[model samples]
Target: MQVCNVCREQTPKYKCPTCKIRYCSVGCYKKHKDSCLPVQPPEPSGPEVKPASSSAVCTDPWSVEDLLNEDDIIDKVPVEKLQLLGRSDQLRDLLRNPHLRQLLRSVDAADSKEDAMKAAMQEPLFVEFSDCCLNIVEDGTAPTHT
Candidate 1:
């Protein structure tokens, strides 16, 4: 059983094939997509090639860490594929917030992993807020301030 990253709920479930991050459900999976999407790697060079030799490095990204790292989770999506994620209106709005944009900029510019993660977590309510937005979008609903 793996623990859900968002809620920390423990359950047996499938993991994201690219990120190897486990989620209890689709809701939880989509919750992480915003942040997770940025880290996906680029596709391998050259046309889709098959190998007759065992020495060839497989173009498949997920296949490596499963055997190499054993416990570490790494995202394995192509860089081109990742660019499409930023096209969403939800993501665009989030990026428009000045503070968030600044924090994201700092995180991207950070030289250390620790600093990057710290910067990324600046808005502690981000995940929950994102969840609420997703629920609204999915249910064809909207929030009312009145």
Candidate 2:
């Protein structure tokens, strides 16, 4: 459990949207917000080389790698395989569905993610979305729809 960045006491239940700093309560947030600074990406160590793949260039400083590293899942999936997700037409098509998007948001925001995922699995659209992503990442090919 992460302690509040501001109070350094209680376990944090919320993260500041701007800086992504954890805080326990409204009071801690109020105290921290004024001094909060958005995290900047580390500067390149060498001469900047343009990415070979368009999908490799992220407009935001934060990338999927950062999120995966935070969750400690970076090693489970190769960066190459993860990049296939962006190139997947089937996955992109699935993401176009609003209901699937809502399910994804619910899963991401839920207090109990396991329970939320279990519920999401009950929906065929969500299952299809998951399968699409898996197919792309695992095989580097989109699932062909009939």
Could you estimate the TM-score for every candidate? 0.33, 0.48
Q: Which has the greatest lDDT?
A: 2
The runs of at least 3 residues in candidate 1 whose Cα sits more than 4 Å from the true structure, single-residue gaps closed, are 1-74, 125-146
Task: Give one clash count per candidate, in the order shown.
Answer: 0, 0
| lDDT to native, each model | 0.58, 0.76
Model 2, range 70-135, lDDT digits (tens) per residue? 533223677788887877767778888999999999987786676999999999999988887877
Write one digit per residue (lDDT tens) for candidate 1, span 1-146: 34777568756254566677666677887787777753466798878767778866444444554544433344333445445444455655665678766665676556564567655655664554456445555544444434
TM-score of model 1 vs. true structure: 0.33
